[model samples]
Target: MKASLETLEQHFATVIAANELSHAYLFVGATNSGKMTLAQWIAQRLFCTNVKDGQPCGECAECRRIEEGNNPDYLVIQRATRTIGVDEIRGLKQELSKSGLEGRQRVFVIQDADKMTPAAANSLLKFLEEPASQVVIILTTTRLARILPTIQSRLQIVTLQSPTLATREQAIQQLGVDSTFSHVLSTTQFSLEDIQGWLEQVDAVQLQQTFWRWLTQILARKDSAFTLVQTQILSTFKEQKLQQLLPDLLLAALSDLFTVKFALNRPLNWTNQQENLQQFANQFSTQQVTALLEIVLGLRSMQEANVSFQNVLEYTTLRLLVVLA
Candidate 1:
């Protein structure tokens, strides 16, 4: 089940009711921040024949078709490869030129739109300038700063923050995570997918062992031998699933180190590995912790750049070792 995007959903429904909706929208936010979910809800609201208050009547034939991916007027543009090229944008323009097959409105959603090539972005800009009467284009991007300036100026920008702690906790329960395990995985913010994923991947006993082993290797090794450990853990699971947990693992590790360094009295979750955490804390200053975060983020960016996961992992491990030393 998807987490609700209640506020943005209401706003979009209001705009549709007012008939003052902009021709284009740029959804700017971090990964898994509800941008795509909001876009779909907006699309359903725009096409729903009977709206009850602010939500679509999921019983309607139109809403059903849209959910089933059978709606003729609704199109979702995702990268067929690493980037959206000029031909894809050109094809969309051709599709838009035709009359709307559906009576109400035609919606096109471009997922990861920041991956649009320069020529494709220019093509999209032309469409935004003289948009079709009943057509709406929605662009979703994690890297809003990288979006074309001309394209940015033409569209209404919606910034979605990470979900609150309470919302994330609710999601953890909704995802059927064991109640006993909630406190450990409950801190993720504004991210439904990550919580859901953790709930799936985690086994309290196994997780404790793996986390301790990983932390131990990082602290004990001098020449970054833990690169092999990183590979082994990541390989034992699905790549996407493992990647989803990286941020949480890193954040937890960092927070523990930070607490010890600052002499804060926060309770330690890593009591079993307290010695290593404290050792790392004493070895690296705040700047080094910040740099390690950048290295982790840099690895993700490289994956976005279409670099192989092996290459990214190798480079990241080497950088992390050097920084730690």
Candidate 2:
């Protein structure tokens, strides 16, 4: 469990202790926001052999089983493909209908609930109309807008707010990123998983160091980035994977730099390089920054064309020089 979710833990534990648990709950947040962890915590609290004030003894056998993803009464339904169809929901419904004559509690967690097709959502909606008191259904999704309105209204809504800056930085550090680079990486990437995935197959530290160095050089020189581009940007980041990510990185880097001009409330990617960012942003009028950002924003489409990643970077550099001149 994440330290940032301590408040949620306290609130939920009290709810469980009071026996006011809702039969169905919808957890909405970014993928790495700990929704699944919270669901598991609820299960452990209910099934723990030694329960105290809604908190479970993590050492208990049942708690261990759930932690290992093998608890018999706890079933997880995840989308195996792009869409979860009606059959999956139907299967879950059938399982719930079985009479336990002995009556043991059962928990079903559906991951990426927004991936469910209309038919599947409708099937689940019918089940929600009259839920079984002994059964619990938990749905997790990153996109609440994609969830059907009728279904959304039926379940208890749990909105996980964006992680605080301290929380995000701490998580980035735990992922083996350097403390110095954590702030920049966290600002560029929305989630910890995204940061991890974005750095995949690349030397994370090298990418961080080289990228910032290259960006700094370009900012300091207004005439041309040709020397830096050839010596640094082109020398490294040659692989297809790195090329594929260049546009996104450029967009994020520039967007973060833009934050300095407006007293923007969002995080900055290069907080340590505030002077450089301010100087770079200061040279550009509002109209110029807007145009430069627009160009970088369109770099994604440029990547999809026959243009090489190196070509894209060089082209972007040329555009920046043009704007400065």
- lDDT (10s digit) by residue, model 1, range 1-325: 2234676787777887888899899998766678887887887887888889878887799888888878989899876366899999999999887777856679999998988999999988888999888898999987788799999999999888756655555666677655433544666332556555555665545654565566556555445445555555555434464554555555566666777777788865344456767777787778887777676665556777777656655576677778777
Instruction: Give the alpha-carbon lDDT of every model.
Output: 0.72, 0.77
Provide the RMSD of all predictions against the true structure, rounded to 1 decimal. Answer: 4.6, 5.9
What clash pairs does model 2 have? none
Best candidate, lDDT: 2
**lDDT of each residue in 1-325, candidate 2, tens digit only:** 2244678889888887788889999988765678888899988888889987668989889899999988868889975465798998899899877643335788889999987989999999878989876888999998899899999999998877657667788988898877767775554424665567656756677886677777666666544466666777766677654565566666767887778877699866656667767877887687777777898887867776657766778788778767656
Number of clashes in model 2? 0
| Model 2 bad stretches (over 4 Å) | 1-7, 10-14, 30-33, 78-103, 115-123, 161-163, 188-200, 209-251, 262-267, 272-283, 291-325
lDDT of 2: 0.77
Candidate 1 TM-score versus the reference: 0.75
